[model samples]
Target: MTTKKILIVDDEAAIVAVLEELLTEEGYTIIKAYNGLEAISIFNKKQHIDLMIVDYCMPHLNGRRVIETMRQNPRYSTTPVIVITGSEKQFSNFPEDSTYQFLIEKPFNLERITETVHKLLG
Candidate 1:
């Protein structure tokens, strides 16, 4: 099987670093972006991104906007996305029909995150 490419987006450097380390050990290629605009730019440049792990709050544009923009691209319309937010209530802001595959609250369990990734990508 081809290695899955996952984009890890978050304003917090620590979160990005930890996620990179974890997912890399799991054998997935990772692309990192510090904020939502950078995330969108990276998303445009990369092809076949198997998944995305995005923080809800971000600079330039929020995660919701980033995901909404990505959903416009037919190639990523159904791509699996994991939105990590500090508050579960933030999820309500997304449209009812949005395609975010998973919502992981802050202080998430690493094991659960890994399981979700495998379930979505597999």
Candidate 2:
């Protein structure tokens, strides 16, 4: 099977590193971004991304904005996205019609994430 590429966006370097390791071990290609702006840049440069795991709060552009920007391009309109947030209040601010396929709270279980990834990319 072909390798799936997943873009992981978070302001925390540790979160990105851990996710990178975990997902890489699952055999998916990972693209890392520390902040929203860099994520956007990477999104533009990469031809195709199978899925996204984004932090709800970030610098430059929030996860919502980043997802919005991505959805603007028809190619990514239906791409599976998983939003992770430490603050429940941040999630409350998001509209009901969120584009993301899943919402995972911070300090998430690695196995849960891996399962979600497999389900989404299956």
Candidate 3:
């Protein structure tokens, strides 16, 4: 019954705020990052992250690069990542052989993400 740590990365402050509140209430330890570069900084210091929920489009660095960066590190190599994006076309731009676990379309259902997190972390 150990607590799962979730890193939520998005440049949108409102989106980050809502997700942080939702996941916190679900009993997961939440780590907040405003963008991909910030997410990397956070990851460097907190190497034991259980899961990562990253938005695809952000300034400085994008979610795909952020996840790729994490995957290169031994500590987070197998950590599950859920990528959120608004455009399916843009999603297709990511590498076909990438290590990310899920690609969720933007304006996603809260329950869907919650269920996904539970399924992955359980």
Candidate 4:
């Protein structure tokens, strides 16, 4: 089977590197973006992203805006999005639609992250 493609959008390079290593080991192709604007640029250029994992607090555009823009595009409207946020209270503002899933609080366990990705991609 072909490997799945996943986009990691976070302002921190360390977080992106860690996630890249973890997901790469699990046989998924990883794309790294340091901010929401870069993420959107990559998405527009690549056009084959299967999933997106975004940090809620990022400079320029922010995760919510990124997902909202993606949802507006017919090509990405059905794509799965997983938001990683440092605040649980922020999740309350997320869309009620099933297309978006979330991981609350920062510093998530690698195993849980992998599991959530599997569940979403499955």
TM-scores of the candidates are: 0.91, 0.92, 0.91, 0.89
lDDT of 4: 0.83
lDDT of 4 by residue, 5-116 (tens): 9999999899999999999999999988899899889767746888999888877787778888788788888888888877554466554446577654687888999999
Supply the TM-score for candidate 3.
0.91
Q: Which parts of model 4 have CA positions greater than 4 angstroms off? A: 91-99
Residue 5's lDDT in candidate 1: 95
The Cα local distance difference test for each model comes to: 0.86, 0.88, 0.85, 0.83
State how far residue 31 of model 3 sits from its true place (Å): 0.1
Model 3 agreement with the true structure over 6-37: per-residue lDDT tens digits: 99999999888888888999999999899988
Q: For each of the candidates, give the backbone clash count.
A: 0, 0, 0, 0
By lDDT: ranked, best first:
2, 1, 3, 4
Model 2 CA lDDT for position 58: 84
Q: Which sequence of candidate numbers ranks them by TM-score, best first?
A: 2, 3, 1, 4
